[model samples]
Target: MQNVTVVDHPLVQHKLTIMRDKETSIAGFRVLLREIAHLLCYEVTRDLELEMISIKTPLETIEAPTLKGKKLVFASILRAGNGLLDGMLDLVPAARVAHIGIYRDHETLQPVEYYFKAPADIADRLVIVVDPMLATANSAIAAIERLKQRGANNLRFLCLLAAPEGVQKFNEAHPDVPVFTAAIDSHLNEKGYIVPGLGDAGDRMYGTR
Candidate 1:
């Protein structure tokens, strides 16, 4: 079974607490979101492959381990994902970014893809798919499926907050990919929103609502 890492770092928890407060100002919320994203990205990339190579030091040559292969390709699930992308990029400044937009049909509640763009050689690079909230898992799953169709085999999922139901559904559907989140909430409400979630991430991030 693939692992679902819920980051318990003190900083992550602290930041999340602030972000959840209804009184948190828009600027404050935005800053905290980025900070938490950077912290989570650190833990998610801990096991990235590395290779040792000889390099010259001030005095003599020495072997030092450096990241191996191509740079990471971050596939953001549209507007909300862009919030997370800014922070992740701070950690891996050279990472390539892709965008995917999906919306849920009001009646059928099915995912509908509006946009998708990725690096030409996604299959050869580590791909991290990101979104702020993992609620119904419809958008995340659909985004993953689209990436797979584009030849992305090395992929993982990342989010700030997730519902247990969404996590279970996504993991069962894509057993080969792992998921990482700052916190996992209890469940989704009838309207498909995660309880105690930070609300619509795209709305909060862009002041859309």
Candidate 2:
């Protein structure tokens, strides 16, 4: 995939498998999502710029590498995105966060924005959009679009699973924004759901129908 990176690490894959099982409890699903997010977060942020600065160690003074540039922002696409956001925060504690409230109209599968909030200086920071499933890509696309309108140029999309159709559509819509996912599933189903997907991520995590 040109702009898409699949995180195929054993831990990520293993946790995803457990998440996909229908019998997994809500608590278990939430825990696994956070764990997988930690693993995936590692891959997405692997290329961050680092600058060396002098630091005093127990025995001597040494120059240590630390992240360079402004703090990155994590733009979450509503209820489900929060699941991934929790773990991503665990990895990047200082990263800023943005919440975009967009819900899928079950009938049309279109994204309808209800609320959006973020830092004022997003234009000078890297924004990583987190949404667990990219089945239709409607919400993710809209969320990124809104962020760009707010001056966010450098951005990336992170998801736990993606459908082939969703991935292609997302790339076409935002070629400049790269995508990172744990797995690319078969395809989207009739109701705009990903086949072999673990079902509605929000519902699963919240124990809702």
Candidate 3:
């Protein structure tokens, strides 16, 4: 829990409860995920550095605060990650995006990479990796490794739910990157799903189940 920050805002908790209900419609699930993503984004980027810049107002020109570094890069991990990405984008409209296509091989519980696309200047920006669940952490770990191979140094991992096992593995693998999550559930189930999680995020978001 050293590098983790849980968003416990009342609105976030309320929305998450609705998302966890099995009877919630697909449309309702998708909307809540996006709405919660906005609140998560606010907390995750709370300490981003700012610098003063000159700006003109009706009265006079004055120094105004602006983000200090290059636009943040959001590295979304495959299908489920996109759900959170939609909401994150709603808040940070100018942030760059990276889509990493990797899925867990259900048998081995390992990750397989199929596609990757991102801005050329990824090395210069702060990369925030988004995924809906971090059960095994294999996919998230693999995705971050791929991005680091492309020269990303500053990074963070954001997820809607995380299992303690996955968090331990992730911290052991990439200690430098902090994790921001809405909740850390009890544990991972036998099939690598988070216990008490709202169910398969991809399935819920797309009606795939």
Candidate 4:
């Protein structure tokens, strides 16, 4: 938990519980994911810099505080990452988006990128990478590596659930990139699934196997 933040608000916890329940319907799961992302977005963006600017407030002109610098970029790590995108976008409507498609090789359990696209001038903006589950950290690490290669420096990682092993590996790989998650599950099962996890977030969200 050194470089990780668990968003344990009552709302966040309640929504996460719904996501974890196998009996929950796909529509319900998707809705909860979006709702929880709204909360997580609030925590992740708490430190954004603000600058005072002159503004007219009905009667008089006063200095108003506004966000400084370029808009943030939300980088989604493939299919599952997209699940978190809509909710984050709902919170940061003006933020840019990037998509990185990385699939895990079943035999080796290594990440292999098939597609990557990002906004121009990423180096000058804050980039937040998103994925629903951080089970092995392979995809997250690889996605971050790809982002850095595209000149993205200021970065953060956000996810719905995280495993201890994944967090350790991710921190070791990219310590500068802080992690934000709703929950840190017990551990990963034999097949790299987080025990007591919401079970295949992408599948659950989209009703896909």
TM-score leader: 2
Output the TM-score of candidate 4.
0.98
**What's the number of clashes in each of the models?**
0, 0, 0, 0
What's the residue-level lDDT of 181 in candidate 4? 96
Q: What overall lDDT goes with each candidate model? A: 0.90, 0.95, 0.95, 0.94
Model 1 per-residue lDDT tens digits across residues 1-209: 14799899999999999898888888888898899999999988999999999999999999999999999999999879999999999899999999999887757667899999999999999899999999899999999999999999999999999998898899888888899998889889888889989888888777886
lDDT of 3: 0.95
RMSD of each: 1.4, 0.6, 0.8, 0.8
**TM-score of each prediction:** 0.96, 0.99, 0.98, 0.98
Evaluate residue 126 in candidate 4 and report its C-alpha lDDT on the 0 to 100 scale.
Answer: 98
Considering lDDT, which of the candidate structures 1 and 2 is the better prediction for this target?
A: 2
Name the Cα RMSD for model 2. Answer: 0.6
Model 3 weakest lDDT span, ten residues long: 1-10
Tens digit of lDDT per residue, candidate 3, span 1-209? Answer: 87889999999999999999999999999999999999999998999999999999999999999999899999999999999999999999999999999988989999999999999999999999999998999999999999999999999999999999999999999999999999999999899999999899999999996
lDDT per residue, candidate 2, 110-192, as tens digits?
99999999999999999999999998989889999999999999999999999999999999899999999999999888999
TM-score of 2: 0.99
lDDT of 4 at 190: 81
